[model samples]
Structures are given as C-alpha cells and as structure tokens.
Target: MKDSFVAEDLMDLALANLAWFDGEDAGDDSGLGCNRDYRDLRGKTWADVRRVLECERRLVADFRAGEWVPDEPGDGPEVEDLELGVASVVTALSALGCIPFTSCNGRAFGGEHDADALIVGFYARPKHWRKLVDLGRGSRTELQVWDGALWLQARTTEDMLRWAERAVERAGPSASHPSLM
Candidate 1:
C-alpha cells in the first residue's frame, strides 16, 4: 500500500470500517460516491483519524509479520455431540470469547432453509479479521461481509467444530487492543 495521504483519501480504511461499530466517524474522509464528498468530516481535523490509522497499521503489520500467536483451543467447552443445537453451538463458541449475535440451527423445516445445518454471524474489528485470515480462516468464512462481521455455515456440528478449530489456531493468545465483538 502507498504511504501517501490526501484529504480525499481514505484515512485508514480500517478505521472507517469501525465507524459502524463505534457510532462515530473519527474524522474519516471516506466520502460517498457520485462526484461529491458526503462524509461528515468537513470541519474536523485529521488528528484523531491519523492516530487511529497509525495504530491500526501497526497492528495489521504485526499480525501479518506473525508477531502474534494463536490462542489455545482447550479454553472452549468440550464438544462431544454429533447432533448439535443452537444452545450447544453458542456455548461452545462463547467459551472462545466469540459470541454470535445472530444464528440459526438451519432446521426450519416448515420455514426457511434446510435442516441439519448451522449458521452463525459474528463481527470483529478489521485487524482481527486479518489475524484469522492470516492463519487461513478465509476458506471456512463466507465471502460476503457486513459491518466487519462474518458468517460460518456448516452442514453439521462437526463441520462447525473444524472451522472453529481453525479460528482458534489463528486467534492470538493476547491482544493489546482486542477486536470488539
């Protein structure tokens, strides 16, 4: 990435991503399209944005450099069942400090999608997503992204466990600024 900065340039695209999570733009200049600057950074200085961007850059660089190590898997609850339910999935993931805000057992036989599947939604700051992806969680994760959130869909609890294990292998043992859920 180029190290240039302009008023119209993205003052840390990572920080702009967190705007939705934090309820503030922090002087972000990611203007809306259509030949106009629509971001609400008109009167604000770029000091805060620069600070955030610098921090995010450092973290991302460090994660990319493998300065962090994945967290242990035994921290999560034991998953011994083949037949899984929403509660079981939630409990297992919560043990890893990743709590899903929305989920479905995919067992809506009389409703939506098919049964025998699990779908869960969760969010994290952009850098954290980088950490996981760095450790190779991209395949299990759906390509569609919303508010820095990700989806994990599996045909069975075992499949979910495999994906979860991959995430655990990537999650660092400690983070100076742990990603917000």
Candidate 2:
C-alpha cells in the first residue's frame, strides 16, 4: 500500500519467478549452503504458482489504489492469510520468488523458542541466497539454512517488516539483477 513501486516491482518479480519456475537449474556452491534442489517446492505446478502470484499482484494493486479491505478466503494465500505484522515481509519474499514456506510474527508472551522475535523460512537459488546474506550484514536479521531451506529471523516484528519493505523497494531491478535471483 505504500506506492506503485512496490506493486510494479512485485509484478516484475512475479514475471521473473514464472520465467525461472522450471527453467534452467541455477548452479549451487555459493557457500551459503542453500538447497538449490528445491525439494520443498515439489508438487507445485506452474498454475498453482501463477495463481498465487496473480492474487498477490491484485492485492498489491488494490492496496496501492487505496482500497482498504481484507482478502476473501479460499482465493489462494492472500495477504490476510499471513500472520499480522509479517504480511509485508512475507509478500516481499514471495514476490522475489523466494518460495516462502513458513513464517511467524512472533509472540513476546508465548511459550515458544522464537518468543519476542520474527521468523520467516523460504527457498531460494544460490544467487538469491547470497543476496540475503549480503543484506543481513550489520543488521538484526539472522540468516540460516536449515532443512534444505533458508530462514530469516529478526528481533521483532517491526524490524522484520522494515527489512522486508526495503527488499520490496529494492526489488525493482532485481527481476534481472546479476547479484540477485
């Protein structure tokens, strides 16, 4: 809902993600230990991905146009389905084709290991994994590869959302950036 930049960038990223959906295999060995095999993304057809992307695009467009409303259920993973305070971050990651698998807005009063912190897990190519590593430097974000996927953790929901908003703003040229996937 910030501006057209985020929407346009998201649309561009969606296109890029679709283009690279089942295309050439991105070489691994970037030292990030990311799983380029994408076993977690198995069973997802092109149509499924497209539906999600299209839904995201429409939602972004609506938000950009100042339309304040919640996404209807059963219409694919809409922004409303995401945990509060982490929707922006998750959407940005999804737009970038990171293939988000899990996320938590974190609970300060909950009995969980991630209490008072934000967490997001996604699958990415080596190049995208490198971008995340570079972005996390000197920041509160923590990057880890576990269970053949990449995870990002931040101290608070605010920090996580801020980091992800930055990513959305910078994802304009990332559709084909040499340093990004």
Instruction: Point to the candidate with the largest TM-score.
Output: 2
Off by over 4 Å in 2: 1-79, 108-116, 173-181
- Residues 1-181, candidate 2, lDDT per residue (tens digit)? 1211222222223222321233233222222223332223323333333344445555555544657344443222334466544556555665555666567656521334333567777767655754565455444576665555666777654466456645644655324321233
Task: For candidate 2, give the lDDT.
Answer: 0.49
Write out the backbone clash pairs for model 2.
none
Positional deviation of residue 165's Cα in model 2 after best superposition, in angstroms: 2.0
lDDT of 1 by residue, 50-111 (tens): 23333433443453476743354212211221122233333333333333445555642112
Q: Give each model's whole-structure lDDT.
A: 0.37, 0.49
* Reference-based lDDT, residue 19, model 1: 19
Error of 2 at 39 (Å): 16
TM-score of each: 0.37, 0.49
